[model samples]
Target chain A: MDTKIKTNNTTSEKIHSSENIDEQMLERLFRQFSQEIPDDGFTDRVMKSIAAVSQEESVSQKTAFSLKAQIPLLKSLNWFTAILSVAIFLFAGGPQLVWNSVFAPIFSNVTSILPVSVFRWTFDDWLVAFFRQAHQLYSIDVLTTPLPTIYILLAVLTALAARRLALLTV
Target chain B: MPSVTDIALVLQVVTIGSQRAFATLVERHQEPVRRFLRSLTNGDEALADDLAQETFIRAWQGLRSFRGSASFRTWVMRIAYHTFLDEVRKSKPTETLDSNQRIEPNATQTDNFMLRHDVQQALDSLSEIERTCITLQLIEGQSIADIATISGLPQNTVKSHLMRGKQHLTTYLRNHGYKD
Candidate 1:
């Protein structure tokens, strides 16, 4: 009821039913433009939309916060996958290729300080078995070379898939 | 009396995401903003209300930037004015001359329907600037300075637009047998 069209209502009231039309009538008619054009629930509609927007804002914000909370775990998983791939490649006869240039001193120190038994039944043992299996496969002329690059490629592809899956779901 | 302080208090509440305060502002100001847009839209109520809704949404987004240099109503009206201008500008490049700019000779009805339709036709006949100036001045009862503030035109230019717009409407009404 806020936007009552004061123009048509008030105009006929203020102007006598005289046949003569003056500039005053014109002014009055124009003044009708200023009259409230009765909203008929327009405000309610606007307020409803406002409330909907506020609700949507809160909901989306909560969703975003939840998404942010998932990020650290996703990142850790990504790092784990990347590290596992690197570790597998390193132990699978790829270390000799990098032994002198990269891993010689670090390997020597690690072997000296760590007992051989400590590496059993863990990822280290898995790495050694994986290399042994790969070496046997290569020795039979299945691969004329020690192909640690394949395991490295697999590791990278695994990390990439994990990264993509994380992104897609979240 | 909706005092300035009360309005300012509501505005402050709105800044903190108070829906009630924002609704209060909308209830208080929606009439004038919608009417102003109605005039701009040539009585296209739906278009006018859409613009009004957009104006309010923009106001809500940018409420924090309101420096209170103008009355809150004036501030909203100014946004309404620019919103109309922006809509017009965006559509201008694609607009063809309204194919039927001339009125039908058969505008002979004396009922409220015809009067309202005739008024809409008269409003649509004016140039956009003239219609804007006349609407702000005559319909909305705003002073020339306030019209300048809302429409972002110089006071003298606003006056000239008002004069020319009124003259055109006078002629249009006279020809239509709407009391001279």
Candidate 2:
């Protein structure tokens, strides 16, 4: 009976010791395996690649932002708002004829009032040259005849047709 | 806290187009990323290095989008994991192991080499997801939340994967005559 008890205790202790050994073995194995990884300029190569990529992206983003900034309409919220307000006025007024008539005159007046040095010519000189050139190029009646009205009417009709077609397809 | 501040400074420098800052970030994270990728790829050092490079490249491209919601390490690890998975998917399907074949030894007899070989072979036999879970949890020593973030899985799913991986490893070890 004592022998049987001793055998069972020995077996249990052996099993316990074996478990401990295995755990230790696993820990050691992990350490050795980790040490096998090469640190040979791997990080340096990665950093070089990252630096190249970052430089490329930064250049592209700066270029894009600078381009966007150069556009007066996109440079400031106030400019966008002003343009949007003008668009809203054009849309709400419902006088397509008035828009066509007023557009050229407003543009002409604004350009005329700006400093003559902007064009490298006096305003009067530019106006005289422009009208003289126009007279030399075409009949006065033909130059004065408005074409944007017809173009705008065609654009509106084409857009409505496109919308209808898109809706039908959907 | 110092590391956090350093990362923040590097981020600021990166934002202002500092190549040095980007290099610093890559240098700092490369080891962890390589370690994680090595485990995921089953000790393929070359593949891990390639994937690590790709991760840094992707991170550089997407740096502007990082919102500081998670640690940069977690974010970069997540990128590396996805890049690895993408490569895995694009490559041929993973070779399936025969159930009847015995696990092969990978290390020598000297100085616990057998133990290392057995552990590595057992790890190789596990499914990719299982390997990733085990690597993140045991090898990389990432927290559960960080593992979830890196694995892009829910926390519960990550836990399940870790549990299943451990169970599989235990069975493999026992079958290989390991007593633990």
Candidate 3:
């Protein structure tokens, strides 16, 4: 290998002189430097450390997940939400069954007492009114018609309660 | 086909508590980080190994803070660079001097090994920042931006260090009649 000292008088001169050096020479030097990477169980040591740390983190995560899974309030609240949702569906459809089984004859009899304008109403008007009243039965109307409204409110409260319980546990 | 993003996803999973993912990270990055630290510390294999371990530990500790703004490799390398610096700070001051004191590999060694050792000693003579720049740029083959991120130096500063390091190495090789 050749050994000869190159000199420079100024800072920029030194920088510029490096540019003049052959590209192949620089590439060779870089290749030589690259070859110096260590190979003696280095990765094993790093992997071992990483394994230790990751094991600790995994343990902590499992503990947190299990702790969240154990909260009684959250468990009860989830059940409450499911049951209340079913109750809401039954309440909304239950009135239709009542109308068909018991109230239809009574509704026909009450036509005489209803206003004469209602009696003169067209088929479309009667159909629209029936739908409108059914909507009223299904609607949550706490300030207006309290029964269905209370059911709706109960379902919403149950959902909110479950969510809050879950949050607390997590 | 695992792209860089796939590797990054593995790292992210590792950060969130996956041992297998962490192992993958170690396997992928160990060589480059070892090479970079070895070059920076002037081929102290034992120290390089220790620093490499410390780097992974530090990376694991700081994994949650990684924001994915940079490539996973760059981020891990930055952690390794900082860990090496922290180790330098904590160790006895004499270690730095010892590293700078050059030694021939072996008298009976082959010519290639001696030449490699000579180049390494010439590298050792560089200032710490210059050594870091040269190691990252030449040995690690990091881009300028990545070197700046790893070294925590400004881009211009990194460039200056690379230029100065090359000039110093060139002068050293010439003095030893190793210049082509």
Off by over 4 Å in 1: A1-23, A32-35, A55-170, B3-6, B92-110
Off by over 4 Å in 2: A1-32, A36-38, A58-170, B1-6, B94-114
TM-score of each: 0.58, 0.59, 0.60
Across B87-129, the per-residue lDDT of candidate 1 in tens digits comes to 8777752342241332233566545556666676787888988
Error of 2 at B155 (Å): 1.8
Residues B1-180, candidate 2: write the lDDT tens digits: 345464675577556866667666776777888988877776666677898999988887788777778888889999999999888878765432232243344444454656655777878877888788777767667899998888888997886676666666766777888762
Count backbone overlaps in model 3. Answer: 11
TM-score of 1: 0.58
Candidate 2: how close is chain B to the reference, as a TM-score?
Answer: 0.84
Can you tell me which runs of candidate 3 are displaced by over 4 Å?
Answer: A1-23, A36-41, A54-170, B1-8, B11-16, B100-103
Per-model C-alpha lDDT, please?
0.71, 0.67, 0.71
| Top-DockQ candidate index | 3
Clashing pairs in 2: none
Model 3, A1-170: lDDT tens digits are 12223333455576667685444565586786567444466666777777777689889999988876676545665656665764666466654565556765565567768745664544335545655676689863344554555456545656676577576765
Candidate 3 residue A37 Cα shift, in angstroms, is 4.7
Predicted chain A of candidate 1: TM-score = 0.35
Model 1 lDDT tens row, A29-52 = 765535556768877888777677
